[model samples]
Target chain A: MGWFRKKEKPQEVVTEKKDLWTICPSCKAHVYKDEWDKNFSVCPQCNFHDKINWKERMDILLDPGTFREINDNVSTADPLEFKDSKGSYAEKAEATKVKTGMKEAVITGRGKIHGIRVVMAVMDFRFLGGSLASGTGEKILLASEYALRHKYPYIVVSASGGARMHEGIISLMQMAKTCAGVARLKKMGIPYISILTDPTTGGVSASFATMGDINIAEPKALIGFAGRRVIEETIKQKLPDDFQTAEYVLDHGFIDQIVNRKEMKNFLYKVLRYWKAK
Target chain B: MNLDFEKNAPEIEEKIAELTKQKATDPNAKVDDQIVGLKKELDKVLKEAYAHLTPWQTVQVARHPNRPLLRDYIAGMCGEFIELHGDRCFGDDKGIIGGFATIADSHVMIIGHQKGKNLEDNVKSNFGMATPEGYRKALRLMKLAEKFKIPIITFIDTPGAYPGADAEARGQAEAIARNLTEMSQLEVPVIVVVTGEGGSGGALGIGVGDVILMLSNSVYSVISPEGCASILWRDGSKAPEAAEALKITANSLFKLGIVDEIIPEPIGGAHRDYDGTLQAVKQALLKHLNILRRVSERKLVDRRFEKYCRIGRFKHR
Candidate 1:
């Protein structure tokens, strides 16, 4: 004797599929994809900055045709012979390369941002959630070394889930390795500006992401060392709505500032200009 | 309910316990012979079990609740220890304890991760999971050690860094990163010992050193065996198999040149003989310190950097 009852079926109406309209995760507003792109993937309704891939990030941040990539050929080898339920790490690497069209998760290069030449390393979260593999660490070190050698401002836009688990302890060593590179750059007095984008957590956040002299985050960017779910479960408490968000980090002083995607360029130029003047 | 190793020696343990209990209950009962015989049998069982322990079994022993924690080791080894608290950037984290201490007539800054002795202490210490504040506090102490030219000694024993949202918010990664960055070039000798579980970046937070020591029974890896098992097989029960494949035991790490020395534990485990283990660690520390202190400060820093730089190596062929 169940109280639940089957209800009458209503007539179905089919509407034309609209690929252009996408819903904002935060605001739940239907926004045109083109409009979102024009606004740098930041939802106009609620200013929720959507995660951007490295190529898109580069195009927006770097001057057109002025970017020169460094350490572009370094890719990860299946050092540990790691295999998982999905497949081997090598197979995943190949698949991720095809999907993301990049050899590694991080793209290290020298580029002009608002006429201020800087060495930049932009991470693509699409590739293995931007897990810092040995190659990623090598690339970051190379970028920092390049910045030090050329005396350019070093910038790294982080959007990673943290260390590459498949690579095992070899992946964990990157945290120390990259930090060592940053230490050298700092000792040489090179400016490092860490830009935290949406979904930067894990080993990536724990290491170089937070070591920036001038740490910046995009509006509503998710930046933290651990995942939200991991934290909530461990603490046995419900978290605040804004926890681990850019606004929350800014309030806590972990980051220097939170810039909207549109005005971030101007803010970088202003900071660069101040340093230049000094 | 029992340790994996204990379960392996259940018959011997039961006999020993029963005999010991009988002696305690009946004053006139001559159970000394039975207790001694059972103890001998238990020893033999322990030896056999430990000698042939699977990686998962080793993991269990490494995380045994009765294992002597950082506090016990510090109390036993260091003389005139004064605890310094707080990161100064945030509140003090009890997960990591550090202070000025004297060891073998040399003043050193000793730091380690403390997994509390009992349930209440464990809860309070976040089960040895360090937060950003803990790493920050460690960095503060390391910097202080550099200022006074005190040798840095860190006893590592954490599952990993705290993976909580608030910890991440406060910059757990950055804190660990900064420690790695700053400690690399500190103008003082840094010695690291893996007294227990050395899980991933949490251990590496203070891991960069002139000499890295690990207990024979300890295991270190990027991810825990259970974590690896879940990811690799979608089954946590596959941890035993995953542990075998991860090659995280002290012997494996030593063979891979990831660890400089392996401090042999007591016959059963460190937990069974705290004083013996402490004395052995102290001796190992003195031996390493005597050699490390002879190296010039610049050379020490260079070697430390070089040591980490050469950790992972493989041939294309």
Candidate 2:
């Protein structure tokens, strides 16, 4: 009991460890933050794709100095007026907005890939798990509309847990709303390329993100309809190590191609290269 | 059959059942007036209790074992039903079922999630939680209906798509995702009715239509109240609070314009009187099916897209 209770240790232990290091989450290899960031946060050892913000993804994918945002002012509205035990959804959303410096989970705009103008919607997972709220849906819908009118290839990079619960049924309807927007683009023969990033599941996976003419994914992304824990609980069994990974879904034929982080832009360019503006 | 809200109705009903039994046993025993009095009392209790029900109470009613199901509606409403099976690419999924049916003057292809009445049946149907194959089966039937130029009527009644390992391995997300786009493009009228638990994406797998009808007491939501509570408050016990706030009941969705019509359930609930619930739903299907029959196919598809396209509320300023 005494041995388990307490033990005194020497005080004032000094160490010269620098704080400017980025540890690879998978391989646990230490690398300089500058070097790691220069590689777009992909682990140099294991090549694990770290979750990147919308702006980081924008910089990595879009051509330099060609990005112009649309519906930037459109933002979240508490349709349910939802207040939980912690606090009201509005306050939480506001705090997330301030924390992420994002008006909404999805930032839709016109950008370029290999000098080809395209309408791209990049979702930021930092904004409430990148839940598809009403504002997110509106922005995506507006992006598709803009793409259709301008005859630009409508591309969206989805990184969301699912639909937002604060807005309740309205969030669920966004699934249908966003899908309808994509269906409109497909009908008009606009090139719609959907990119699935690190984590895409639930309503986001079950909507526009999976209906792209050429569905693409980042390497080893967690992509599925239900969460891993939920699947384990429901089936009452241990799942395989790679249950819903991008490679797993590719094997199952859900994803068209699993592109590496460095090669993503090149892959998109190659796919959309032949489709002239029409 | 006895809901927590239906306070004294069960006791009154028991008394009536007992008195009626005595009357049946012996003609000499005059228990008619006593039975009638007890019956009137039960009716009063039921009417008072159902007048104002909490959202949690409504969810209970919607999930009641005695609540009418897809099979019950098929038996009571459809003049003829030819049950279809298999998804062509994979095995048949009993979680969802579809077939050709005639309700009133309209001939339509009907699809719906099926929950079981007992444990064995529920297990067989995976408690109405569809796996990826279930959605694929539905999409196959939907495409068949389109090819035949028949209107599609879908019944949504599930906790959600199955959240299981096998479901994920077979690509549940893409199965539902593909259905949404395909259903939207179908050149035929589509009518959807949320008969019970319209849980999230699974419900929407077959939920899109020109007219969305929800039965009274049925709950439709982005996620189940319990699921929402666990995710938001980190406490599953707060489900009642979550249910109230989510406005999952049929009335709230109707007010929100998520649902087109609210087919009234019998006093107490659909579980109380199966025929009453069946008749209301039959009437709704008949009225809308005929009206849609008159609409041009091109206009129907366009209106369906527009209906879903304008479903969100946001700040634009």
Candidate 3:
């Protein structure tokens, strides 16, 4: 066994060299990839919550091996036969599926967080910019429905640019659809904890992302309905550097807390435990 | 209020303009034949143009300055209307108008985005770009409709919600979000009509309804084609292409099941025939309102919830 481990060092070093560096956007520091992953992708220098895909997010937040995905079978179709300069939405969807290894931008499922069962739907920014389309919205609604039916708490970690432009009005409709889902969950007395990760904007911010009973945002997350450029152009004024950041929103009383990445799971667990005790 | 592509119809529009000038100057230089000929040519050109309008053309038609605005809809369709103002949480927003009115003897609450008809009004109303107060004003009116058990009607026509820093500071996203949650649970028949540019959260802020309808030439999209183009292609001139991809036309929305019905426009589009457009809209609203009124509040809310929930769903193998 010792001789075999020694022989594997050369191959392991090659893999590490290929994947072991990430630049921190905040501090502009080169971070060791392994160290970053070990810290749940939070930059050790500036503590920036580096953008992560849904799978990584789920693994960080959910109890090990406890995620049972719901609405995984539901998918989107090219209903309008939408085509852009790049290609048809169908081709883009296929490409995104291969790139993200997920059927949709959002992954909805039930999972355990510190032994507390909760239904969660985490958005994947890598999948079509984490834009909310019809499928993404439907998955969220289905997740909430599952929570309401089975009496489980709900949590959603949102990271999106906005609504899916390729899906058009079908995407816009998701804003109302997801909100209606959240409303039902609330009516059934289920608690919803919405965690806004880095860059939650557009239609998503204006809907279920902001509809949570307890809206939690990651530190420095960008959360707003309009892009900064759009706002600047509309108002004809320069905005503050910190405008639309999670801290700014928190100062404005829009969100409840700005939880750090490393403590997010424990914080959620504590909240769920409190609800359970009540 | 000419469409941007009207410039391309020189044989029709330019000839008509020139012949009208000729007639005015000569008082009768055999201009009658030319006028009739141009008119016929114009009709043919219009038919061809309207038959296969690109998505961006539909967007232009929806935003045609002469298109009947919210005030026209209220004045023409409502038997009587009492205008309501203010969100109760902030100053009144002229961009959104709400009131109590009767449609075909059925008491209903009418709310809509007001882009304002003239230059002065347009500036005053911010081109129907709603502030957070506007959404809150809508919520207040919706709640009143629920309290009185009156059916609710909303006319969506906005480029988008206002994107000013002040609006954001006041929680524009939160205001729009609250409307979505509250409207879904409101115990009344809610009907939404995409009357013009139903853009993003601005539209969905009051867009959730038991039946989502659209005007024949209206557009409802998550973002303006120009914005989408600029974001995706880094050029606003690519808006025509973006519009095609966005699928914002009422007909496209109907095919996708996002729209419940499409109210036909007059031959030259709604702006050319305000009275005709108003009458058609009134009839459609009354018909849908009658059918929807038969439903109990619980069923209406349930169906409305289920209708939106099922919008983008599909079977994937």
* Residue B154 displacement (Å), model 1: 0.6
Off by over 4 Å in 3: A1-22, A276-278, B4-45
Off by over 4 Å in 1: A1-33, A276-278, B5-43, B163-169, B228-233, B312-317
lDDT of 3: 0.89
Q: If you assessed candidate 3 against the hidden native complex, which CAPRI class would it receive?
A: medium
User: lDDT tens string, model 3, B1-317?
Assistant: 56755545555767778888888899857888878987887777777778888898999999988899999999999889999999998789999999999988899999999998888999999999999999999999999999999999999999999999999999999999999999999999999998999988898899889888899999998888999898777899999888988888998888888888999987778887789999999999999999988899889888888888788877767
How do the candidates score on chain B by TM-score?
0.92, 0.97, 0.90
Please give the C-alpha DockQ score of model 1. Answer: 0.37
Q: For model 2, name the residue pairs that clash.
A: none
Tens-place lDDT digits, model 1, residues B1-317: 37755655667767777877887898788988888877787788788778878778888889888888988988898887999999897798889989999986989999989998878988889889998888889989999999998899998899988888677667777788888889888999899999899988888998888888999999888888887788678898888877877778898778767788999998788988899999999999999888988899989877876766665433322
The numbered model that scores best in DockQ is 3
Q: Residue by residue across B1-317, what tens digits does model 2's lDDT show?
A: 56878998877877887888887889789888888787778888888998898898888888888888899999999999999999888789999999999888778999999999999999999999998889999999999999999999999999999998878878888889888888888899999999999999999999988999999889998899899889888999889999999999989998889989999888777887999999999998889988998999899988888887777855468
Candidate 1 vs candidate 3: the TM-score winner is 3
Higher-DockQ candidate of 1 and 3:
3
Real interface contacts reproduced by model 1, as a fraction: 0.56
Q: What C-alpha lDDT values do all the predictions have? A: 0.84, 0.89, 0.89
DockQ of each: 0.37, 0.64, 0.73
lDDT of 2 at B279: 96
lDDT of 3 by residue, A1-278 (tens): 57868988999899888688977888988988888889888889988888998888999999999999887887766666777667678898998898778888899999999999999999999998898987898899989999999899999999999888878888888888899999998888899999999889988999999989999999999999888998999889999999999999999999999999888999999888878584
Question: What fraction of correct interface contacts does each candidate retain?
Answer: 0.56, 0.80, 0.88
